[model samples]
Target chain A: GESVGLHLPTLSVQEGDNSIINCAYSNSASDYFIWYKQESGKGPQFIIDIRSNMDKRQGQRVTVLLNKTVKHLSLQIAATQPGDSAVYFCAENAGSYIPTFGRGTSLIVHP
Target chain B: EAGVAQSPRYKIIEKRQSVAFWCNPISGHATLYWYQQILGQGPKLLIQFQNNGVVDDSQLPKDRFSAERLKGVDSTLKIQPAKLEDSAVYLCASSLVASGNGGEQFFGPGTRLTVL
Candidate 1:
């Protein structure tokens, strides 16, 4: 079955340090990938996205990298802050308009 | 511009009871979606609507769940005789259309349902 999954259930980082969250998808035909951040008591908010044709994309203090050969994806946060603590989710869109989401990775940033 | 709007930020009901959730999408959006998110999991799509018609409901539990989008703007999801496993957050999202980069969706705060 088609599925998207994360390599870790939780990630912890000190304030001002960098953080990385990883994801993997089973479908190779997936054309688009998105990363979302969900704060406590809030809905998931869009972070960044990368298309299959592109290996990397950056936004603000975050970057998304895609490795099509390994079917892996990663999100990097620079200078992590306490406000960055949230559950992060990765989604894959296989031209279906509806993206499949993976179990989220809880990111805890300590000050 | 306003984002998606959902009513009754939280709901608690007994098992076998019925509950309904309401959603109002962003203005001018043509695509709407409903998703269920468990405590420790990502949001899962339950159904999708393109304008006023249904696009996908394969993951929806038809035996207990029903949804409708009237006039292609607002939507309502109803679950009758709910089960304990049905306790989850119901999220509503909408986009301009179902394809292309413009299809990026904006989500609402969601309604948290708890079945006792």
Candidate 2:
């Protein structure tokens, strides 16, 4: 399942499928971007991050792609699992060290 | 390293009541942040502190919301005469420093506030 809009509230996908969650950032001067996953009853946790100078960063089972031209950031999960179900949010630091978070996208993986 | 820690994992209060939340950032971390997360929404920055100094608090509602990080270690957030709209999860996060790199912030479990 894929959600590319700025306000992607939900994404439903089957287990073992790939998932793509997108975020549209508004800061043109942001040099740092991060992706976070928040589970129920817990705070948001860091997923992956990329500097403006970089285009993509990969982590275990996760990949983050950043496009400066369009100010778009996307997180790709290789194999969606039940444990991966959560609300995903993107944060951008516009040189202030204070990140502005985007609206969250809740991903629901079905077994 | 230990993650940020917050007190009162859950809170229940009525309108016009007062409440306070506490936070302890990871050891050695100099930057602390407080965020408010409403249901189905992303967390919003409420205030930021750098070693006991207020860095950014533009988003904080100074009228009723106040926070302080004393001695550059633990912090506290208080709400006077809480309103129903104030119901949300209050999260505390910490990072190494306030820099251009924007180091990943480690978050606490967050205090869920419900105002009646």
Q: Name the docking class for model 2.
A: medium
Interface RMSD of each: 1.6, 1.5
Best by TM-score: 1
lDDT of 2 by residue, A1-111 (tens): 222235578999999999999898766888888889999999999998899999999999999999989879899999999999999998888877778787788999999
Q: Where is model 1 more than 4 Å wrong at Cα?
A: B99-102
lDDT of 2 at A18: 99
Tens-digit lDDT track for model 1 on B1-116? 99999988999999999999999999999999999999999999999999999988999999999999989999999999899999999999998977335478888999999999
Error of 2 at A64 (Å): 0.8
lDDT of 1 by residue, A1-111 (tens): 989999999999999999999999999889999999999888888898889999999999999999999999999999999999999999988977778999999999999
Q: Give per-residue lDDT, candidate 1, residue B10.
A: 99
Best lDDT among the predictions, by candidate number:
1
Span of 10 residues, lowest total lDDT, candidate 1 chain A: A91-100
Writing each residue's lDDT as its tens digit, candidate 2 over B11-102 gives 99999999999999999999899999988778889999989999999999999999998899999999998999999999999989763466
lDDT for position B99 in model 2 = 36
